[model samples]
Target: MVVRTEWRLRQQSPRFKPQRRQAVSLTSRWIIGLLTAVYLLWLLVRTVGQPDWLTQLPALVSELLRLVEIGWLATLLVLWGLVWWHERQEAGQRLPPLKLEELYNLHPADFERYVARLFRQKGYKAAVRGRSGDLGVDLVLTRQGGKRAIVQCKRYRNTIGPDIVRELYGTLIHEGVSHAFLVTTADISESARAWAQGKPMTLIDGPTLVAIARSLQLSPPSSPKAS
Candidate 1:
């Protein structure tokens, strides 16, 4: 009987990716909006009052106003589209089916390597932190537009507790990184959720891992391993 091997080189976990934060804060947006309004109002005043400088450029003033109006509308449309896209991405965190058996068969060291690959598949500058003294960080992920986020993978057979979450969050604060995550093939305790709340920490449980693996649709290894 042929035991069809069912492992794929899967990477990219929806759990590891953060829900995009507000790229533009409200205060900055308001400040820019106010300044634009003031400038436009001043321009209108100058044109209507026909100031000496304004009188010399009657045609140019009208053309500039028309261009400004068009530009303003275009800017609004772009901003709206960006916001819509961000929201859609945030809402698209659906879990998909995965070959759980294959993932379960991975050795602990292999699991770390696999997790690193997953982040890389998602376009992160990712690497395993090495076994020697990593300060509890297993993987480090970076991107051009995002701050470095550290990851810790756990291939445990049981649920974890709040202390694990606390440790990761503490490391995030101490290192001052932008984000932190804990990925495990197990559930977390209620106290764990309590600690992770309102923090830049993510706790990815087992089922979530399966979904990310499924989404990756990875290819199996080229050859069978020696027994």
Candidate 2:
């Protein structure tokens, strides 16, 4: 018998929070302005100290000032680049924030929507059949060149066992699908993983789901909705 239980998505790290709009911090603006003033003061001090060069030729003074301006501009550019690099590195280290829909509260039918959104973003034509009468298979996605797949979305917190894998294999044969995808927010049993090793089925666990969420850039659902 096939047992069905509700599964919740794993709790996400705060670092993965997504920003809805862009806004500059007051502190950052203040720091930038302060640094600009300091650079200008330094240039003035340096120009005043070089009396010998200034007295030699008035035209050379203009050239010297131009060079100083160029140097200051280059310095600002370099600083901006460094700041950008640092922010990007932090973003890389931080986890992408997930929405309510991405969580475990999603229904089995909702799995089809998530899968379609993910695969469609990758330039594939996918259809969601989650509401169909199939117990194990939730979706049927077809790619170009006559390739078709059967997919099962398990939103269970408990580890998937060999029986589930066996059931999918049976459905794959029954449906005559070339590939099968069994995805869940929880881990799969060793036996289940082993059972899928020599088969056409692909098993995706919790970690894999996070990776997919990051790759596809799916926005987290603000409110939990029934699948």
User: What's the true lDDT of residue 168 in model 2?
Assistant: 91
Candidate 2 lDDT over residue span 1-227, tens digit each: 12233322222223222221111322454566687888878677757776565557788777987798888778777766766664444333323424434646554454445554555454444555555477677767666666788788887888999999999999999998788888787889999999889888889887787677676555422221211
lDDT of each: 0.65, 0.64
* Tens-place lDDT digits, model 1, residues 1-227: 22333122222332232211422432344655776687678768766876786556789777997798778767766765665575445333332333455455555566666676556555565556646677788888776666788899988877899988888888888777888989888888898998898887888888888777666655431221221
Weakest lDDT window of 10 consecutive positions for candidate 2: 17-26
lDDT of 1 at 121: 50
Looking at candidate 1, the ten consecutive residues that score lowest on lDDT are 218-227
| Candidate 1: residue 119 Cα off by (Å) | 1.2
Highest lDDT: which candidate?
A: 1
Stretches of candidate 1 off by over 4 Å are 1-98, 218-227
